[model samples]
Target: MYRAIKYKIPVVTAWSAPGTALLVTLFPDISLNEAVAAYITSAVVIFFIGITGYFDKLLSWIPQEVAAGMMAGILLQFGLGLFTATDTMPYIVFGMLAVFLLAKRFSPRYAMVWVLIAGVVLSMLLGKINPVTADFSLAIPQFIAPEWTWSSTLNLALPLILVSLSGQFLPGMAIIKLSGYDMPAKPIISATSIASLAVACVGGITIVLASITAALCLGKDAHELKEKRYIAGVANGLFYILGGLFAGSIVMLFSLMPKELIAALAGLALLGAIATNISVAMGKESQRDAALITFLATASGMHFLGLSSVFWGICIGLVAHFLLSQKNRNAVPVTASDSKRV
Candidate 1:
């Protein structure tokens, strides 16, 4: 709301799931303080990039297919969990899957909502919901002093910037443009970068322009008049503020749910994203080999030199692309006359 008012453009920000997942994966390798510092550093760097309007240029350096492949690789585990979870709680997982498929077919927009409701109901009936004894309380933001390290910057911050830009901001800006908005990318990126920095100490992830939710607001479903659609953004922000106030309760509630249930929910929720990324990664026949290499490397979970597989996946994929593309470029096309002569 502040940025929208200041810049006179419609902007809505949300916590990026991919960015958060990247940081969460780092916790096992780095200290919480280091992860915090790396995230803050990423936000600061992204802020400068936005202010200077260089994000587009930066994005141009990374191949979209390669980036998509890396993301697909990173998210493969969650997708697999949707099935692996069935091993323990077959009934619950299968029930949620059926509900998701039915809801998706009929009410595509509310599929996840239906899935959640089904999961909760099934869990409750099966005695899977854990008793929560924690008292409801307002979330107190804890400021952790960040400790920056070379590993954290290379492994966490760098991958975070790449994924957040490729996965969130690009799609979000495209949605805005598709919706007939004349919004510039600079202001939105700049605003969210600053917001991410502000909330980094409180364990907030990169706050980027909303992609999926942005589509909902930009559509006629939000409002009949396009100009009045900003009201939906405002309403969304207000709801987010309300949710933030009771973050503690939300956290406690999730913690009390069965881990298998949570895993199933996450897997189903991300199934679309995983499929989309994989399709994009392999869409270009020329880039198929490179994208596949990147995806496999990332999904393999290979780590070397204290860096995650994501970094290596990008490196290997780019190298493969360069070499393979160069080879194709150098290959001479045989002419029909030449073939007849031969």
Candidate 2:
């Protein structure tokens, strides 16, 4: 709503899961204060990157197949969690899975909604849902001073930028474009980056253009008329504001649900993204070897020299691509005329 009115674009923004995960991975055991500082630094850097319009150049530096492979590798665990949850709660897990598959086939947009309903009903019937003591008070935002650290700059900040750009913004912009919107990327990036910086002090991750939820609004289900689809975006933003006010209550509600249920929900939500990335990663014959190397390296969860597996995945994949391309270029084809001349 804000971005549309202010920048006159139809893009919507949300807190990025991948960006949050990078922060968690970087500062797993750190205090909240320290985490906020790291987030602030990342937001500042991303804000500058957006305003200067350098994101396109940075994105071009990385191969699309390689980036998709890395993203698939990163999201693999969540996809697996949907099945792994069955070990602990077979009935609920399978019930939700069935509902998701059926709904996905018949009415794809409402699959997650059906899955959530099935999970809740099955859990409640099976005595898995726990009672929560709810608080109706508004969430109090805390202010934390930004502290710049060399390690965070190198590790967390850099990865956050890459993942948010590649995993979130790229696909998000693609989704919008596919829906026939000629929305400019620079304004959207600048708006979200500024929003992220503004809210970082309140324990917020980077605000990014959403890919998954944005699809709901972009499709015919949102509105038959394409020009009027901005209403859905505005409605989403209004609900987000309302949800943010009761953030603590929402946290408590999720906390009351079984961990298995949460795991299943997340897995089902990411199924499409996982499938898409995997297809892209293995799609091209020439890029298959490099993409596979990247995927395996990233999914292995290995860390070296204080860097995450995602970094190593891209490095190894790029090296493979370069060498393979060089080999292809240097190989001489033998034809009838060439053989006769030889």
Candidate 3:
């Protein structure tokens, strides 16, 4: 429906985040059926909730860079996890890295497209793709029959809402701002939430607005230079529907792709985003220590008090920052240029 999608760039960009999830879930022994279901459910909920004025105010409060960093932090583990399984497909990783770096340095606008193209070319040349044995079945949309069990609701639904809110939605706001695009955050949020709800009803995982990778779409480096890039979102929605329908086929195709490919491509895809976030997060001397602590704690994989380390880490870092600031404040002279005795 959106005009930008005609070029297929936005669709590719949109598909990156969910597509990776799809690949990981369907290919490996473990399937993220619940996560996927949650993602879709979340998307729908966000979409509807976005129609409110509250979301507009909320978006204005959060800083864009912080949101981007938060997104990168959320996906850090997923990207790093690729390296662990890259041994089986070294070329995929190498190709992804090579093209990614080249694109970033040379043509930021088309980096993702090039990386994807390179990945495909390298995979074909390396004889890594197994098209012959891949399955081509379609997956009919299956509705999730919600059973009201305390554990299921609390452990799954509640946490998902929180994570999507704090971890996903807030950060998405930051990203929208960071890219210098003052688009209506509420509508987008509501749209994504509603999309999530739709997916959840159909046995899909929740998908909140993607703050981290959304930059890939919004950034100057991702899409081909054009005025109608919004079509990319439309393309993304189409791919989502297609992937949902041909989920079996898509999964089978991804299964044949190398692990290194997934990892390298993911990491490569996120490089620009990561650099921008780190730059902004560390730019201010006041927030540097706190932000770094937040980054490390999130990256550390440590958990305590029934909370993810990322959330706790930011909380702890914020407290430390505030306390340390008080000490510094007490020592500073009340007036500027106070060389004379008061």
Best by lDDT: 1
Query: Clashes in each model (backbone N, CA, C under 3 Å)?
Result: 0, 0, 35
TM-score of 3: 0.74
Ranking by TM-score: 2, 3, 1
TM-score to true structure, per model:
0.73, 0.78, 0.74
Mind giving the per-residue lDDT tens digits that candidate 2 earns over 259-316?
9999899888877667877888889888888889988987887767645576677789
Q: Which candidate is the best by TM-score?
A: 2
Q: What is the C-alpha RMSD of each candidate to the true structure, in Å?
A: 5.1, 4.2, 5.5
TM-score of 1: 0.73
Runs with alpha carbons beyond 4 Å of true place in candidate 1:
1-42, 131-134, 142-189, 201-239
Error of 3 at 330 (Å): 5.5
| Candidate rank order under lDDT | 1, 2, 3
Residue 341 shift from truth in candidate 2, angstroms? 11
- In candidate 3, clashing pairs total 35
Q: Return the TM-score for candidate 2, rounded to 2 decimals.
A: 0.78
